[model samples]
Target chain A: MTAAGFPIVRAPAASATDVRIDPALVRRWLVTFLREEMIVRRGMRTAVVGVSGGVDSALVAFLCAEALGPANVYGVRMPYRTSAEESFRHAGLVQEITKIHDVVVDITAAVDGYLRYEPDASPTRRGNVMARQRMIVLFDLSAKYGGLPVGTGNKSERLLGYFTWHADDSPPINPLGDLFKTQVWQLARHVGVPREIVEKPATADLIRGQTDEEDLGITYERADRILSLMLRGYGQAAIAACGFRRRDVRLVWDRVNATHWKRHLPTTAVVSPTAINEFYLRPVDY
Target chain B: MRGAKSRPQPSSLLGLVPRRTSLDATGPSVELAVVQCAPRKGDVAANLRRIEEAFAALRHDRSPFPDVVIFPEASLSGYFVEGATVEVARRAETVVDELARSARRACGRKVGPFDVVVGFYEEQDGQYYNSALYASLGRRPVLRHVHRKLFLPTYGIFDEERFVSRGTSIEAFDVPYGRAAILICEDACHSLAVTIAALRGAQVLYVPSASPGRGMEDVEPANVRLWRDVLRVAAAEHGIFVVYAGLVGFEGGKGMSGASRVIGPFGDLRAEAPFEGATILRVRIDLGDVRVARAALPALGDLEANLGQLSSMLARTSGQSVPAVGARAARRR
Candidate 1:
């Protein structure tokens, strides 16, 4: 129905255009979020972010530098054996602009050490090993440098289950979890991120010529719109009616539905009235 | 302590004639402050020290000290405490005495009476209730009133009803400034509580809230936007001053937006704190505005008279037993 509810026809509540955000307000808000979460709650003065030369990590590095001083933010670049060389150059661009502390730890030997035992491992299995190895290095660096690791995942990647289940989402705090990938681009540009890195295709560097949109079977623009609409209680038919392809909408919806387990802590069976996670709930930092 | 200068006789505050006895049930133009501070989760001693720092900050900033200061709900213990409610909960009387002692010690030789309205988890008997206390500190310490939160929001990110027992009543108790009532957080979201306060001749409604900011689809946090609408409507329709004390800082990953504000009887914003971290919002509120607004709009007056006409509808929808203190407050009116 329209504003006045008549069952005959309905106007789309929101379309892809509604995905725009106020970048200045978001920048200020997330800056305070990072500062408060790190300094006040965790009692840390530094943030360690694995800068992939991607927009999400670049934006988080900029925010971390602004929240704590530039000297306090550590931008670590962990490239795999077959990783693109452009990833480091782009991360260098972010570091030059942010003037953050830089550290580079290559995971070729560590990931290869684990993969040597499994010679027939596929690219997906090898990618998970590389990703998990990167997490181990960043966490150990956090302990050594006294800086907490900050997450760089965005809403689209999270909802689509694009990132590794445990390795990528293991950070203690995430400031960009609520922002979509397209919105992340909007924020990265507003925060004075270099145009070269912001315009680059997002990649996990799992294999040569591998891009996120290619693996996901949809563009971030289309997927973000569908996810945004679906989040507001829109169904597959309703979203497709808004000029979205039924196949694309179904693909996005299926990914979101299939990944519900990835977004939550491990589920436990309830034997009695109270279960570990069922009835026992506590606030974070508890 | 500065007592009401125009008191005609020495009288007990309770069981007074239920009418607007003095100054339209209005009183002197009072200086008020809302202490919007963040309490650490389940740490009352640390929060008490935080409250003391807020008091010191207030004394350093303002002059002609405030007559009243309000704090956000669960200011002693943070919100979202599920199984820890019993551990964090405290007796209202004991907390009031401790608040009085702290206030006196902070004031140091500067003696003046001021009322403190603070929210906490209350452990009375063996039950736990989300409660707020209004007590005097400084010259003459007195426990004036206690209001248990009537509405326990149990949806979305909230699971309040699961951990704590719900309060049964909405009552407007007598305050020195005028007859005022306490509505803790979600309690003010309901119009019935505000209407009950207006019916009981309360000119001020003290609302202490600990709301996590969400819905980033707007320029401001959506929770803050909706709260402004709720409070403005409550103040304008009821012809009462609405003092809102909001919690600041993050609990878990949830950001508590702090824009502690005061709305006048005419629905005009008097003062507001920033949305950043903790800050004290102080403003002067005239109780006579309550008399002026009620006289001009007169909606509460109509509500009182026409409520009997809607009794059948109410009797049908009144869910449980006697609305304990709200019914008593309405009966007095």
Candidate 2:
């Protein structure tokens, strides 16, 4: 039940077309976006993607390979000790198919190096540490490899605040940032990502058995529809009329409302009217 | 009465513009070039260099460019420079002089009796405006007209209203061949600007836009699709040629898809540029088509004839006091 006094009754699932996209158009746009943002705008000819065997990163790898040929893309596979072996295999699948510059830098020692000091740290903290440590490796490699660090988080995870804040969304440019997870899967299929990787349950691979759906308590398919509708200014009553489960709507809405800060730059106290990003803005270079 | 006889003609008496009645019955043909550009953000000098290169290329190949050349809105500065617009803003007079000089230098000779409509952030009387300048560049250059954008879109990725002051006028200016009007970006979305230009006997409407392409659900970018619809409708309804020039390249991840095109008098796609990058969409437009189309429909003619009556009805509908010229308008029609 929602805090707004709605029932928790289950409803029929929405048609996939609710989050469907024209894959050809989307692929072209993303390729253009990647080239413009990374190469044309910043003079970075290459890109390094932190491929985690998930659909999102794999899709980004495929796009980067297409944008700046396969040779220019470095697909770095980062696995902690607890990460599933399937993660490494899937990341390998992406590298094999795209023929991207394959690289594997296991982050176990780096994550464990920090966590050994805090033995009683919670799983969430430990996962965050792993995520941050992977970012450190990817960024350092970006310098060594002479490539931009491509972001792989989709709009659904961004809205749900599913990924670590700075560590996951910290890349300078993202081709998939605006696309919802369902749409990302659609684009993934169009761009020829492996069927197994496309069909697999999405996971961060920070824990052994953790899946994103299980952690979020809702399917990405449902959450995306709700998030898209909510952002389009549909109220609770309007959304409920669209045949969404009240419980799912509540979960998606709460997460989106709660994690709004994760999507933004740190808010600074405005002592002057001309505060940057508040009153002052230079849109292109931001 | 605000009928055809009482219609406003701002420059008719000055003899700067030939009145509509005096124009040849068989209107002239104009070769138009809509140049899609990816202007560097906050760097007016770099963008100017690009503009100069475009002119150089055009003049080098064809000599005297074309009858009309249109660039995208904020061609002098990229679209989303919110506060940086103040730094890039130029006075209209200064811009025309500089543009003329650049064209002459690039062409290595006196270049245009041609019209060039270029959009820029403008500063006049200590006020800033998003403006499009229509000028005839040659040995004797004339600042034909400057259309300061009237409707500044403030919501949804646009903060134009906050950065620039709104323009209050929408009038067609006389080109060497015929009358034409400029509508910068958001101004084209509002039908009133087009209607005013149509009433003033404009045969061509130039829309310079820097609108970011949005949505992935369709085969084409959503904004591009919508702009096509609007451009088509505006062209066909008013029996005018609609030339749209769009910005290409991404601005902070917002891709401005360059789908610039020319919509004919019959609401058909005359010529279209590619969506990916900078390219010129060149097409020869016969102004005679305007007369043929308007003759076929006569919608603009009927509206101009009965405007005084419609104004009173509109006032009544909006709960305002009605004006007194209904009988005269009906009789005039």
Candidate 3:
């Protein structure tokens, strides 16, 4: 039985639906993890977060303000000229609610300057450039303000490889990295995030009228549930039997397998008996 | 010469000394719970509140409540305070009174009375000691036993000797669960202390430790493995049950290993908590096993026979000086 007097229920081997989380316990765990990772392990008193007006970034900013004082938390909003006005407004709402130090850096010139040389550049290239530019700004502010840059990407996006490498995925500390996108929404509501932001359509805001579901061809709710079942070693057949479409299960399974490289360190050819991070290993805190 | 001859012969040769049978045979069985909690550093009230919440949670679930609840060493004020002031070291009586009240309030009328054993920096007259207080709660609370740490570790990452005064005595005190003894963290490192307590009729040894986790691998921490070996050997050798309650969480950038466990007299692990986070490890132990194990081995009986001889040998060696090693070699040549 858990601390809440609820017996922990386990799914049978043939079943595929056993992903339940206690939000209160998860909140306590995440808060403690953030406090320990930032203050105790990294010796940082301040945190910097990139708030994009999305649920994921909004939740990260709120958690950072809760872990470290609002004065110590800095929220940066990086918007290109073509970014949605609603996104900017939502970011402002988060800043006001969390009461964190806010900075707005318009990246229209930085992104457009790089794109001028390649006017025929694809949308993906432009989106990647914008994401990297925002990261550079966030990191510079982190150095100037003596705060660690916090990552806002969630587990669902990470498994789907829906982020730019070394851009949106790189941070010294990440509180929401382990939580699924659906779980992030759940925790956002629990932490009193703005309801408008929580209910907003998930998007990258890099291009006009582009939504995450439209790009991925699957909803986060369905994808998160499929990923949950897949993570528990459930086969595609088992997942399909659990009231999920067979094609959706197969798509998520293939995406997770194809993007396995994004989740791990670069593979090194081992010549020595003990390689770094293999045998002669130490924790990042160490 | 006549008086010496009339004195009784040593029990080793004559076997005239009647062996003291195990008291555990007649003692009642005990249920014990060890709490591995992450305490907020130097926050006494918050730590107490955490303990209260755990206790209330256990009772509300109607789980098998333990007869004795143990917390980690320095759990009230935390460990590794460089220069603790008098305000940091709380009065033992006050903490005990509060715990007793909380325990009674949480488990009142539904369960049998239980005792709480917790570690804290205790303040007496102008001096402080790293101590464990055992409070037995029934109609009211009673401070049953207090054991100050005997050996203050002064090695790497440990400057306990510089911070707190050392206790000078080893004893076994009677509690609700027969004769039991308390040993703070470093005291468990000394086998002689455990031996002395076992010899003094302690059937159960409660070791409250604040040992930090040390290692680089994903397996059990080195300190945790070492503590397990220590507790296992002590329990098996002395034919006593051992309960080790360890603190968890980080303080001053150091991580604590929270592998709290209960070991039976046969050196078997009854219950063990994980290496991280907060957990309550509970186990039911039949005190009769202490008597059964000792009756099978009878090492305590052998120690009783040789204790006098060992004492005399130590006395004689202290009174005389041995020849130098070089001189003895030269004489032999």
Off by over 4 Å in 2: A1-17, A284-286, B1-25, B62-64, B110-112, B317-319, B322-333
Lowest-scoring 10 consecutive residues by lDDT in candidate 3 chain A? A277-286
Q: Report the number of the highest-TM-score candidate.
A: 2
Report the C-alpha lDDT of model 2 over B207-256, residue by residue, as the tens digit.
99987888767898888888888887788778788899988888888889
lDDT of 1 at A98: 96
Candidate order by lDDT, decreasing, is 2, 1, 3
Tens digit per residue, CA lDDT, model 2, A1-286 = 8999998998897553387789999999889888888877898998999999999999999999999999999999998888888989999999999999889998888888888899999999999999999899889999998888999989999999999988999988888888999999999999999999999999888878999999999998888889888988988777877888888889888998999899999989999988888887777473
* TM-score for predicted model 3 compared with the true structure: 0.54
Q: lDDT (0-100) at residue B70 of candidate 3?
A: 90
DockQ for each model: 0.52, 0.60, 0.03
Which regions of candidate 1 are displaced past 4 Å?
Answer: A1-17, A268-275, B1-26, B317-333
Per-residue lDDT of model 1, residues B69-177, tens digit only: 8999999988877888988899998898778777766776674788899999999999999999999886667888889987998888888988888888777777776
| Interface RMSD of each candidate, angstroms, one decimal | 1.8, 1.8, 12.0
Q: In candidate 1, what are the lDDT values of residues A228-265, reduced to their tens digit?
A: 99998888888998889999999999999999999998
| Per-candidate RMSD, Å | 7.0, 9.0, 17.4
TM-score of each: 0.90, 0.91, 0.54
